[model samples]
Target: MNLKSSVGLLFFLFTALAKAQTDTTRIKSYADQVMVRMNLDTNIDQFIFTEGPEDKQLETILMTNNKTRLSFSVDYRIISATLSITPRFLPGNNDNELKGTSSYTDFRFRFFPKKFIQTVYYKNIQGFYLENMKDLFPDWKEGKDPYFQFPNLRVQSYGGSTAYVMKKDFSLKSIYTQGEWQKESRGSWVPIMDYDLSIFRNLIDGQKSKETQYSFGGSMGYFYNWVLGSKKRVNIAPNISLGAGGMFSSSWDILDDGSKANRENTEYFIFKFSAGLHIGYNTDRFLFGGKFNVNANVYNETENQSVQNNNIFGLLYIGYRFPPPKVVERNYDKVQKKIPIL
Candidate 1:
């Protein structure tokens, strides 16, 4: 080839290379700006880039300039080259199941309507679920106890509950519990269920009540259901929690002679008070949780230890947490430098 022609070709090639480098730098600069605008300056876990006609967008660098999409979608995946952009948004939530680990701050509101999956005590476990089971009574109408007739008693129970998140963690939640015991004298076998369904609200702001808190010498909030922790391993993923609260309660004594104890006329005052302390380990399917709850009442009128009544209830339960999942962690590492693309 002629020397002149060769020189011209080389010049053309150099010009094209320089132009490409400039374009690449501009695109990268734009992506960095987009990240700054979105307040997501940190290194991303993984970003999916998209634009269309899909192929029309070049993979110039790690930086992408789709700032317009920062607010509308997650990341994009360009499947074509027509510039027909598909703004992919964050994960979709069907029912209450959310994708991936929600931010710590968002953990509270993200897992709402925490489904109630009660794992009844061993005695209450008639089958797979309480929902479907033959009426143990088969004919309780003719008898007294709904599940049975004569006098069957239920003793020993276990279970505790909490809000189950997508990553298999628990949060502020209402507990659950059941207790009953009976002895059959003659008639039939029956199940006894005695428990209170109540919400106790207390506040300790100068010994007063407020919207979300309560105070006194000490403060108390509304809660029921006590499930203590277990010293054993029962499932693949292990979860444990400790809960406590104080509130007013009553004492009831049931006599086999079909006679009730001296019932006290209730007044609008703190008649009795109690505390609940629980520790539990729950699995996605069965939560073998246990708890120890104590209720004591020192007669207000007279401070007499003998006159006061103190009772403790310990139970174990096997239930399920909603959106049951294996616990996971989303670790965030600060990005000081960009990783080179291989």
Candidate 2:
């Protein structure tokens, strides 16, 4: 080839390389901006890509103008093209499967904007019980005990809870070993927290006393996906948490005339420890799961009267898993950034 022609070709190649590098840097800046807008600027565990076959390589990138969100994959796939909303409907027997009906609904929304997903939940329960009241107060006597005798003993509670789960997905490489075709399993460790407030009513004989409780806590756990059959998988997660809260009970007195009088409020500090096991089956579109939770609460009113409460419950839930939107990768070189930088 002539020297002039060779020089021209080299110039063209250099220009292309520079442009590609510039695009990589530009997309990264845009991603950081989206994180800041979503108030997740410091969260390193947030995932911005979708999981797929390793050979079917794709690069996902997020771009935002602070007001508008745009995302695309390297192969021009629409990684975050369309948004999806899934509403979870759950109804089941009481926590202990002892009696009563328990139900709750959750609404989930996802967006390409910081890959945001939000869940809002509300629950109403009646006649739900923890355990026999006699178990907590073992030294009960008809007239000698500080409390009066009742025909039946049980608890009724109703409350609402809200939680934020950081959006995340397993990448293909992390799901498999190097050069191995072992069925790639998906797993994610995300930050999850919830707040709950409830009113608990205790029935003694035929009379009623009420208490209000407030609790907030966070837990870290891994959701491991296992293939159960063709095109089907099961998700299992185990978690532990610790929390602090308080409870306020309204004091009431029963007169000799069989009348009831409301007294002042009695307050107690509550410390909570909980462990949960969750198992679920999932198709490409829907997921169904059963969760068993056990928690213990230590209540201290003073140095004299301290009590321990145990709660056990089972919940069944069903929801839809929306398809991830098309992804656009601007900088394919940095696609494998470590996630959940725990």
Candidate 3:
């Protein structure tokens, strides 16, 4: 080849390389938006220039990190199974604090001809929401606020759900769950009724209370996936979900006489919503990516009393894909000889 022809080829190669780099940067930018919103600790550069094989059909997606672990595999892209675990963390100056943890297991066994998918899931979560009470009394003097020490609060919840996915992007889910909590408050808190009774009344100061809630709810969401790069190896998906439910709750306070007092049992309502973004680089060998989710929940007992919870979190993970198993053939005559007559 002539010298001018060789120079032309080199320029073409350089241009293609520059375009590939730019696409990688764009995917990283989208990942950054989700991470920053949830305050997750991640390095974008570590993920941008990753090395992997060319894109192919992925039968499974597995990912894990300090806060979340997810593993899901499928058969013929129709029948699927998944396992996920999520842990809660509260940011602190020196080290992050563990707020809670939960486990989720599900199986998607039913598939309609071309339009629908269904999943049955079971979940159990145990944690506490400590931020609200802390914000309520930021500076409590030890002597003056003797009854106002930080609450030893704990919440336990378990539930199951059935989800239907339609057209591969939209989903409608219904869930039934039960939860129990031990809660307490002091320093003269207002009650949630027509009367002016407070939690920290003269009759019931520094008392611990027990509450239980049963709820049924449904959620609707959509997910969109974008593939970038000439080889279609990089993928990103952003999803949004909204849900509402009614809950039956019952709570009673402990009186100074070591007996239950002010027994109140009533039904309440709750609403929740969340938005998440996920990014990954998938190849024949392995997959790597991170997901960030921000969510909020509101609980209302009466028209005048309500509690709100807002939380943000995310996870980073790397996973490997296993090869499909080989099919085995059996001889009918040999099997019949080994069988005993009934």
Candidate 4:
């Protein structure tokens, strides 16, 4: 071939090689992501990455630092079947309220706290709203004006709320703000008439006084109690606690997003994990309890990468009771038999 044709052929070959290299690079990157997703950990160095007949890379669609849509349950059958208890703590830092150790041991009965078999879709701002269905306002009466259509906005959030309960069974409650609580309510920040319940408490072992016990509960929560060792009067058994739930949006966002970008529908997930101390005191009518809760949680918002965490305090509260578990008492002297004729 002539020099011109040879040069042209070489150029074509080089271009093909470059394109193939680029494709290979992209594939590797994608594979690395996949592996991370499968492992559910950002630290991918734990796995060996290579290319072979039996090896291929992956793309990670989900990353889990704290919340990555995972659930864990413990069935420590032998000592206890199921129990629900929570912790109470108070944050000393001026800027935060729940900033230290927290715990919620038992709250598996309320909300029909069954086996936690339901998958509740909750978050702040948009707790539970219809999405797949068409939005339609109620029809007007004869002389009434035509009602407008429902707004197309979604504001799903998940954050713990503090409230004051005066009556039992949440007959009346006042909801507090979420993060970095403000001391003053501003008077206009009318608190909600009621809240589901508060799971944090302070175990006041001082004077005989009623240490305000907030009903320890989680919207999407459950409990599985298990006793792993021999039961004793001063029994100290290790345990685990997990609670997860989401919050709802308000009507304000509904109106705003209704007439705007219509891109405001998203959900947030909050999960709490507590592992610390569990002390149960047996009584006939009630059970005195104590828990020094240390908890860590992850807050996740849809379509966002900046997932946050908080070390919630005031999550450990005492004074929870249950049916008096039967205790067997034995005397060692009655069974001691030794030969005296030595």
How accurate locally, in lDDT, is each candidate? 0.23, 0.35, 0.37, 0.23
Q: Write the per-residue lDDT of candidate 1 for residues 291-320, one digit (tens) a residue.
A: 444443332322211122234344444432
Kindly list the per-residue Cα lDDT of model 4 for residues 300-323, writing each as its tens digit: 333333333332222222222232
TM-score of 1: 0.21
lDDT of 2 by residue, 1-342 (tens): 432353344344333332322111001011211110010010000012323455553323211101111111111111112121111221222122222222222222222223222233333323222222343456654333332222232233333323233323332111110100113334344444545565544566556665555655554433333333564355344444556666666656555576667766776666766554455664434445565555556665555445555444445544433322435233422353443210
- Among all windows of 10 consecutive residues in model 2, the one with the lowest summed lDDT is 36-45
- The alpha-carbon lDDT assigned to residue 110 of candidate 2 equals 23
- Candidate scoring better on lDDT of 2 and 4: 2
Among all candidates shown, the one with the greatest lDDT: 3
> Candidate 1, after superposition: displacement of residue 321 in Å?
7.1
214: Cα error in model 1, Å: 23
Error of 3 at 25 (Å): 25
